[model samples]
Target chain A: MLYTFSEVLEKVNNEVKDLKFERKPYSLFEPIEYILEIGGKRVRPVLATMAYNLYKADIEKTIPIALAIEIFHNFTLLHDDLMDRADKRRGKPTVHIKWNDNTAVLSGDAMLIEAYREIAKSPKEALPEILNLFTDTATEICCGQQLDMEFEQRLNVTTDEYLEMIRLKTAVLLACSLKCGAMAANAPESDADALYDFGINIGLAFQLMDDLLDVYGDPATFGKRIGGDILCNKKTYLQITALKSPETGKEMQDWINKEVFDEQEKIDAVTGLYNKLNLKGLSEEMIESYYQKGLSCLNKVQVDDNRKRELRNLAESLLTRKS
Target chain B: MLYTFSEVLEKVNNEVKDLKFERKPYSLFEPIEYILEIGGKRVRPVLATMAYNLYKADIEKTIPIALAIEIFHNFTLLHDDLMDRADKRRGKPTVHIKWNDNTAVLSGDAMLIEAYREIAKSPKEALPEILNLFTDTATEICCGQQLDMEFEQRLNVTTDEYLEMIRLKTAVLLACSLKCGAMAANAPESDADALYDFGINIGLAFQLMDDLLDVYGDPATFGKRIGGDILCNKKTYLQITALKSPETGKEMQDWINKEVFDEQEKIDAVTGLYNKLNLKGLSEEMIESYYQKGLSCLNKVQVDDNRKRELRNLAESLLTRKS
Candidate 1:
């Protein structure tokens, strides 16, 4: 009855593929289909299902809700790509690049509405709680994005602020996904709350690991252009850690302050400075701390240890993934 | 103890001013405040409270739901300005113009989430129906917008297609507002359904009047640039009617197909052609038909005539307004 993580992911994928978007408004719906077809890890939905499976064996019951999470995530990405002026996603042109800003904006709004429609399809008793949690999570994600844009204009982003930003922008939805899944199974409040906390920790660790991988991972396996964060001067954990370091802080500041330089040179210079400050070690330690916290939170959930094995395995796999 | 329409508007205005948006993230929250401050007529919320007052006199209980409708309307405008690339709204700079495009997009998304949060605060008994109606209406609005965008590219749109577009884009929210207000009062489903139909009729007439005003209304009273819709070649009811008319369809097509001309001359030429086709009479007749239908729907509500007076008066005032 309990499905493996990969099995859940396949269900998520199939559900996504079966999503109904009319082709008449080709300009509007095309971008939606295009973005969904080029998939991410479907991680949020997978986590939601995994959490649900911990309580109930009916994976089918939660598939729509999981799809809702996936659609909502992609909706955010559609708008984010415009804000970030990102040209590529999933090795394909970003929605805005493929269509235009207006198409991306309108299509993304439609996707959000579609997400809510999906959420509204939950069993009547669970509908109110799910809607409340989902709306709050959505608001927080927007706040996180605004903070991200704000940080881009500032030079003095503290590590704490960075963590909070990523937590809102990236982590809360994951937490919400897991919590909502538990709720879909009619799990007890205590267990749901514990799963939420576990998700927050795992999400934080996952994002911190992402920050590390951006700089250190191999280009082929990373599936993205390496050194992009450095080139764009994104305030990742490494950059913040290096900026706060007593040893290499001054040199990192010099590189950040340099007005004129080749792009690759700047990336290399920042990488060298980060290495000198041993930021990779600092990042790993930070991620490990969150991962351990996540494990402890998982321990707090009252489910049998055997029931939690897949969730634990999924979290570990995500934390240790190459791409 | 029932409030008059003006009293409801005053309450709506006060409630909007009292909304709590955190000031720290000025870039995000400021745009929201800016747009809400440059307020429109607050028509949707006003309609909501009127419908609520029809059943119950407890105006205070419904204020939050009313505020939610108001916020949602402004949210649409924020993004609509971006999609239309309009520079002004309500005689001031639009959100995108006042700040920037990214600010408008992000802040609009935040406002939408805030709307849902407001909806979630409804009395627990009303929350589910309210959310279901709200989400469905929101999706209709988006679909209507996409249809509008699609219409912009084609010249062969029929009158039925145009009406459907306006119904989705403009009418449904008003309908939802009234129905939601009635639901908040625990009104009978029959009464709520009647109010929704009344709103749809009123909304269609209102938008049709808007189209008429764009060409013929006095600029000073209209509070916006006259003939602006004609300038942009927006496919309004009058334009579509003229295009389909056998009498002057050719001349109308010529004016529409013209590549370059003085703005005022184009306006004059279109106005001349419309006069030749007697479009003003046709549009007035159309408005009158919808207005009459709206009144009939209002008459169908089982509430006593005295209880229905404020709504009827409000409808008459709107139908005859110069602006």
Candidate 2:
């Protein structure tokens, strides 16, 4: 029996909520509970399940793998929140802000271990491949984060470098999710590889859309302050592309170099420069290219088109998200 | 042919040095290199190799397991240094101090993934069991560290609580090391269990000895300042025991509550109280009890006495260590 995307999401959420975290060490487990409770889209697990259902309708066996990806995602966010010194996550105070840095660090470490415990629960035959893939993904994600940090300290980050960073930091995990689900279902190597590629392209397009929305999305719908990237001088795709354009590059650089500019004014000037350079149109074209590439990869999978409708819908929903 | 202890250490060192870490992200790997270079005793890996040799002389097959435990040990230290906000490790600046806290956190995370990478390299037959053991040990260590941190903020930590924390934080990894090596060797489960128990007891004794030396040993030999633990008011077994005693508990409480007390005066007073209570003797007795338990566990292992000589010697060296 094929399940809809919402059904798959509900199953994943139930499994997550049912996890019996110990309550003795309130400092460690409390923050974990807080983060997991204030959930995201559960996109990774949903993707994993949707990929599995396309081959094997038995979602029971894939829940651990799904949970593993979810836990690992939260673990990374816990640390990323600390590294970014973020005050809020999903509209609540971050683990570090609510507790302290040490609590955040140690709790995050435990959560990483918890992620592995879930990964290990995969059927023995699939364990080695999944573990290897997960390890590589984990290492690449770290590299991606390091690159992101490195970029933050630099004034001139190339578009190429930024894309690679996001690919590592964001796309590989999505790819790993699909590939892992396929592996759990004992899908053929070719199909699994195709799903991975499909995920990577979709992930890239999804991130590109996120960059675009941060600037142009309506404030009431986006659930975040507009032009935050511009205010922080974050070297996102639009910023990098605008800075790379010869016509407006110098002016954009001058705006970025201003030491004591008002925050709102800086956001306005940068957004204005972005508009003048028509970066939004360029970014849309780039996103569409990746979206098409992703669809091609999905088409290459041997599964019938009908079986892929849920995954396709998910990709579309993510790309079109206003928040 | 079976290798001696130093030979095993040298083999592990060569394998570690031969590992080709990426240099592009110097911030992540550089701190890892720096910490590994300022080496500890490599006790965990050496114990692992010795346990493997006791059953199977093919040390070649165990190199990856050895390296895995060593890397995991170093990874813990990297984060532990940051959590404790310690300035120096082994007479050199910590990763956080040398690079920064974020560097320490991310690099430690990468090293942990690297440890799993090494563990995955274990012979296929031993991989799952070793991974399960490693994961459990890793989680327990985190729990232990959390307990330690929690205890730091409280004044009424019990001796049993302190023992359990140290066992989790310190002993379990040692036990895991020996048990993993035995599993790799396909040693009898009974013998493997005995070796694990032996490691736990030895590890407890080792930590107890460390606490004793921190108060009584010569600074030159200890490689750290005497009375430093007392100065920081760390709730070691010594402090916990003294605080629990009816005869001196009141005086100990008063001394601990002194907000602006002179550091030297506090240290002198604490040392005087410990001497009055003969805590040094009580601690030595506790160490001997654990050491004896460890030896008894070793005796229970089915391996020939000659096959056990190196492990016995290593245990003795650790027990008698001044630093």
- Which candidate has the top score in lDDT? 2
Off by over 4 Å in 2: A259-262, B259-264
Model 2: lDDT of residue A151: 93
lDDT of 2 by residue, A1-323 (tens): 78999999999999889887884566678888889999898999989888989988788899999998999999999999899898999899999999999989989988888888889888788889999999999988899889998999886888889999999889999999999999999999999999999999998998889889989988999999998888777779998888888887898888888889888888888888889988899999999999999999999999888999999899989888889
| lDDT for each candidate structure | 0.88, 0.90
Q: Give the Å shift of residue B202 in candidate 1.
A: 1.2
Give the Cα error of residue B7 in candidate 1, in Å: 2.0
Q: Which candidate is the best by DockQ?
A: 2
Tell me how each candidate scores on DockQ against the true complex.
0.64, 0.77
- Fnat: each model in turn: 0.66, 0.74
Per-residue CA lDDT of candidate 1, range A1-323, in tens?
Answer: 67888788888888899987874456677888999999899999999888889888878888878988999999999999998999998889999998898888888887887788788777677878988999989988998999999888877899899999999999999999999999999999999999999989999999988988999988889987778888878889888878878887888888878888898888888899888878898889989999999999999999889888889999999889887
Worst 10 residues of 2 chain B by lDDT: B19-28
DockQ of candidate 1 compared with the true complex: 0.64
Q: State the lDDT of candidate 2 residue by residue for B1-323, as single tens digits.
A: 66788888888888777776774666678887888888888899989989999988789788888888989899999999899999999999999999899999999998988898889888788888889999999988888999998898887998899999999999999999999999999999999999999999999999999899999997788888889998888889888878888887888888877789888888888999899889999999999999999999999999889989999999999988889
